[model samples]
Target: MRIEHLAFNVTAPFEMADWYVAHLGMQIVKRGETGCFLSDKSGMLLELYEDAAAPALDGFSFPPATFHLAFAVDEVENLLRALVKGGGRQEGTLRTLPSGDRLAFVRDPWGFPLQLVSRAGATP
Candidate 1:
C-alpha cells in the first residue's frame, strides 16, 4: 500500500502546527485535543500530535542528518530565506548538484530538518 500520512510527536504541537501553516503553506484538515492534522499543497497529510508521557524528539540529540522531510520547491534560495525570516534556521550553504538540482537545508523553530529542493528536469 502507499503511504497516507506521517505522524510527528512534538512538545508544542499546536504552536508548531501554526508555524507550519504559516510558513509552509499547509492547510489544517482537522484538529483534536492532542494535536492537529495538516495537508500539504498536494494533499498529503501530516499528523502533528503531542504525547505528554513521551518526550518530544530533539533534532540535536537525534541528528537531522539521518532524517529530514524534503519538499519540492520552485525557488530554493527564496523559500529558504523566507523560512529563516519566519523563525526557521539555515543549516549550511546551498548547493547545486551535477544534475542541476538545487538544494538548501533548514530547520524549523523547534528544530525539525527540512530540505528545499528545486528539481532540474521531468519532476516539476
Candidate 2:
C-alpha cells in the first residue's frame, strides 16, 4: 500500500494549519481542538497535532528529526519566490543532483523545513 498521511507535532495547529494552507495551497479538510488534517487537490493528507504541553516522545525532549516533509513543486523558482514573499526563508540554493533532479529548501515561520523539488527533465 502507498503512504497515506503524515503528522507533525506543532505548537498551534490552527495557526500552523492556516500557514500551510496559505503557503503551500493545501486545504483544511478537517480540524479539531488540538489537531488538523490538511489535504491537497489530489486528496493527499498532511496532519498536524498539538504537543507543546505534552511530555516528550520516548523521554526525549528534543524536536523531531526522524524525517522532514517535502512539498514538491512544478516550478521550484516560483515556489521559492512565493515563499520568500510570504516571509519564509530560503534554506539554500537550488542543487541539481547527479541524476539531474532539482531540489531546494526553505523554512517555515515555526522553523519546519520544507523542500521544493522538480524531477529530472520535467518542464519548470
Report every candidate's CA lDDT: 0.88, 0.76
Estimate, for each residue in 58-88, the C-alpha lDDT of model 1 and write its tens digit: 7655555688888888899899989999999
For candidate 1, the 10 contiguous residues with the lowest summed lDDT are: 56-65
TM-score: model 1 vs. ground truth: 0.93
Q: Per-candidate TM vs. native?
A: 0.93, 0.81
**Model 1 ranges with Cα > 4 A deviation:** 122-124
Query: In each prediction, how many residue pairs overlap at the backbone (N, C-alpha, C within less than 3 A)?
Result: 0, 0
Clashing pairs in 1: none
